[model samples]
Target: MSPKPSRGTTRTTQYQGNPRRILVGITGGSGVIYGVRLLEVLQQKEKDGIETHLIISPAAAITIKAETDYSSRYVEKLATKVYRFGNIAAPLASGSFRFDSMIIVPTSMHTLGAIASGVSDNLIVRAAEVALKEKHRLILVPRETPLTLIHLQNMVRAAEAGAIILPAMPAFYEKPKSIDDIVDHLVGKILDLLEIENALFKRWEGLSYS
Candidate 1:
């Protein structure tokens, strides 16, 4: 088990300067599109020196094929670096391997429970553990509906341990016309958390009430 962080520990580094490194983990959740779109958006921001290190879980490969038209190889090409799910020896497993933040988009309930319990059985969870222990930003984008009490409790546990629980719920206040619009809104929210400027989706300009 990874060591827990102490209360009120400050972040080791900020997302300043060029070449901001971000670690992205895509699990087997149904909304793999969010993960893929995040990569696409980050790839577009490569000129801004946003470097992405990606990890695709074994189950995520199956989800990608079942959900999206793009091949897994194609998805890997969007990231600056890619690692296998089972590679515990990867540099990301170490807290010394510096990164600005870690985002696990479409975070599976199983993954949530594992991270909440500090069970680093695989590279993704290990990397997330490093983020938490190192006091770096860790964002989890859970995509399940009708969440069970256990699921909610795990989320609370992870949150208490310094993880940001960002769900995959899309808002209708934007009046999105297509699925891409909805996905972009959530991806844009992720970018907002990263403090990266983007206009992927329109911001909520207050409505006029007559």
Candidate 2:
């Protein structure tokens, strides 16, 4: 059987490279802001020699316009390289192209289902499959609530295939002060999963019952 998800800190281990390569896939989902904020954080990491590769699905482009003020063009500029979702020929589609990790922020149920079923009709799914087959990190942040049995089964299938199924659920214990604070909390967790360091949100120390 595929190994159970590692409860250890293996995900935090940084690979040695001048510029650690990270691939991001954005699908059409309600929380487009999660992907956008993640891009913003990684762009800053660019100054520290981190290379960010991006692929935004066609539906994501529409979601970006519908949900946020920022244009997809602006988001594209945040990445070191941006690939078309339909470009199955992109380097990321090959397992030979090395990247530290791949994350699909605000991943749609459709994309999750596709990945679960080993469907690689698009570059995003192909790259995610590459990550899984190559034994590299693949994180999927699904945003849907009131999940149906089908959705849960798909999630389980993806997890069994060695993908990190991170739902876009925020913790209120951090005492978020604004919308950005909540977004940062989720982005920070994604960074944490990929072993990237960040101070995007307040960490909980402990609770005092006194």
Candidate 3:
């Protein structure tokens, strides 16, 4: 089988040392803006050796255009490269490709379920599975709501396989006043997981002076 359909421009104008080989997968999750914002932050962090390899499932393309001022064509330019999900033969589809990590910015339930069981039908799932088997960082930014038992079970399975199930749950501790704030907070958390340092939001460690 192949990954879901997608449409948008594919090319990037951002480049630097680009030492970071990061594969970013966008599923059909609701929080599409989070994925886009995450890319923007990472793009600006080019000095930190960040490079993005992107692949957005069909649904993600539609949702991102619907929910934000951005278009998939424009967003695609933020990354170093982009690939169709159908191309499982891509470099990222193997453990030897040597990526620093793979982040599913807005992982959908279906995609999450697929990864949980070690299914490698497409590049996103394969990249993640390879990351798991190779012991590289795999961060899942799940964006589902009112989770069902099935969702919980799948998350558990992925976690057991060394995938960090970091849902798109925003923190209120930053007292965010806008949607961008919320998205930025979640992106911040993701960067932290990728071991990239940033001051995307204020820390809420409670009365801390250090």
Candidate 4:
């Protein structure tokens, strides 16, 4: 967990000595914007030694086109490296590949179930499994609503295996004025899980009942 910053405190974007390698997996889910926004933020942190390795699922490619105006190629360019979804032979699929964390933004229920069941038929799931086996941070940002019992069970199973199931639910405490504000808040929460300091959204302060 990231230390809560005091109100009005400014965080420096100083470059840390060692490179922080993060593996990102985007799946086919409704809220594809979350994944895109995360990539944009990470791209901005490139100077801070944050290296992003991205893997976009096939279904996600379709979702990207359907949901956002940005091209899939543009999204791929944001990452330090990109991997194919079906390439299980990729370095990320191996437990030996050293990475700080793996985040699956907009994780589909299908992908969640696959990870929970220890099924690594694809590179994304394989990388997640490796993250678990290697004791690396694995954050799953599920975007589905009205989840079924199976979905909840899968989430529990994944959580038991050391994966953080962070849903794409934004808070209203900050009094968001636009959809971008809401998205930023959720992205900030995800950054907190990685212990990455950010001011993407205003932090909650004590209630002020004047």
TM-scores for candidates 1 onward, in order? 0.93, 0.93, 0.88, 0.91
Model 4 TM-score relative to the real fold: 0.91
lDDT tens string, model 2, 1-210? 756753322443246755788899999988989999999999998877788899999999999999999999999998999999999999989988977889999899999999999999999999998988888888999989899999998998888888888899989998889999999999999998877889998888999899
The per-model lDDT (C-alpha) reads: 0.90, 0.89, 0.82, 0.87
Q: What stretches of model 4 exceed 4 Å from their correct place?
A: 1-18
lDDT tens per residue, model 1, 78-118: 99999999999999999789788899998999899999999
- Residue 10 miss distance in model 2 (angstroms): 3.7
The TM-score obtained by model 3 is 0.88
lDDT of 4 by residue, 1-210 (tens): 533322221122223566788899999998888889999999999997898999999999999999999888999999999999999999999987878888999999999999999999999999999888877888999878899999998988888787888898888888999989988998899899888889999987889899
- After superposition, which runs of candidate 2 have C-alpha atoms over 4 Å from their true positions? 1-16
Give the Å error, residue 159, model 4.
Answer: 0.3
> Over all chains combined, what TM-score does candidate 2 have?
0.93
Clashing pairs in 1: none
How far is each candidate from the true structure, as Cα RMSD in Å? 3.3, 2.3, 7.9, 6.3
Candidate 2 or 1, higher lDDT? 1
Q: Give per-residue CA lDDT, model 3, range 151-199, as digits (tens).
A: 9989878887778888888788768999878888888888887767888
